[model samples]
Target: MHKYQKLNIQKLYQIYIYLTIRLLMNVMWIVLAIFLIILIFERVAERLGIDRWYKLSSIGWIFLSIYWLSSFIAYLDTDDFVNMLLTLLAAIFSFIIAFKIIIDNRKYPWKNITLWVTISILIIFPFYKIPILRDFLIDMVANHTLFILSSVFNASGEIITDATIILNGFPVSIVIGCTAIESMAFFAGLILCLNAPLKRKIIALVFIPVIYIANLFRNAFAIYAYGNQLFQFGIIGTAHESFFWAHNVIAKIYSFLVVVILAYLTFKIFPEFLTLIEDIISSFKKDVDK
Candidate 1:
């Protein structure tokens, strides 16, 4: 009886420890989100150069805080879909309010809009959890990627399932994060933020397709190499066997290089955007130096 009672005590203690760790983790996430929101608010207020911007931003921050806190708690409760929807709604509402406030302020419209839009995109992009939209994007990416692979490799590639391409009987699954939507969205945000003519901005949007194509090419090449066992030899062989290094390191390096080249070409065409990019880079450099 004493042994069984001791065992029960140990089990209860373990459960208590597990619950405490989970609660702490959730609290940490919420705290980090709050810090990020506060930083964004300060930046926006400074950029707007108005005291009212702080007040307006505080309202938005409140909405965001509720979204973050509730979402974290809901995640703990395992209601992920509802949490995502609630978070999205809250973020959109906050964005609308903040955007209106920025437009009303009107002092450096381009800069303010750019900052708000970029921050808004960064904030809400990760929380996207709509099932239908996710499936649609995956389908599009998978089908289009397989088509491109077939055209490039002169080999038959088919979509074995949604977000999965089968090449030579090897199945490669493409997740939402791997679909190049994030890169395209980032470029779009940058273009929208540019202090350029409407025509120039529209012209800049041509790079979106370029980025998508580049990503498709990257994915196709990596999948081909992986399927055909091309990069399976040498020092890379061991790493390739481990999935993380294979896809994230080798594959991501290639894709990042492609993006860098594309970005260079883009900046060459829209030289005005380079100024902003330079300023951003210099600011980062200064921060690092400090």
Candidate 2:
């Protein structure tokens, strides 16, 4: 009887955690739009030199950071150590910036952060909630990924109409994140918003398609790695070590470096954007020196 009660408590705790995480994730999606609007207004106010806007904007930033904090807590449950760490770091950065804004509430700082983060989130957030758009992108990614796996890699795989790939007895579902839509959206939004010439913007925006193709290849590689049990050496005593290494660690590091490189290349094409970034840093540093 005692064991039964203890088991019930454990299951109840799991359910509570699951519900809390899902609730937080859902709220973040809804609030993404709110933050984008606030930041857009703040950006305009900064351009107009309205110091009063900082008061409202800084508060909004503090509130908006709940998204990152929530994500950090959610990843703790999934055992995604890398993502959990990254989200914690992001939450810290966001809160630090918010603290600075609050301290120097009248001073106009975070201009570039206002520009880039808002644009990126605005572009990326909608697709997550919009069913048709999410499904379309996920489906396309799964189709091409499976096709490349079958033809180029000579891997055996079949995609369920529901966007799951059963490859080499490993079933991996292709979600919207796997489609690389977020990164593509971030790149497209940043380039389009930059104060660069139309020609330069066009050139930088070309990276979007490049990113899409690269993401397709990345997904195929992950499928190959997992399906072939490339990292299933059982070193971690997990039967799914192949997937954990491929999708969580190796693929993530590769994707992060690739995005950083692509963003750097875009900066080279947009000198004004780089200057804006430097100015944002200077603003933060000035507050720190105070």
| Top of the candidates by lDDT | 2
lDDT of 1 by residue, 1-290 (tens): 69999999999999999997775545424433543564467667678774554344434444454555566556665423444555567556555444544444433433433354444455335534567777777787777778778898666877775578776666789888667886787677767666667887888788788878877777777677666656554654453443333464566677668778867876876676677656545544655697
lDDT of 2 by residue, 146-191 (tens): 8888888899899975899988788899988788887887787778
RMSD of each: 11.4, 7.5
**Candidates' lDDT values, in order?**
0.62, 0.77
Number of clashes in every candidate structure?
A: 0, 0
Q: Residue 263, candidate 1: how far off, in angstroms?
A: 2.5
CA lDDT for candidate 2? 0.77
Model 1 lowest lDDT segment of ten: 105-114
As for model 2, its CA RMSD to the true structure in angstroms is: 7.5
In model 1, which runs have C-alpha deviations exceeding 4 angstroms? 1-127, 234-246, 281-290
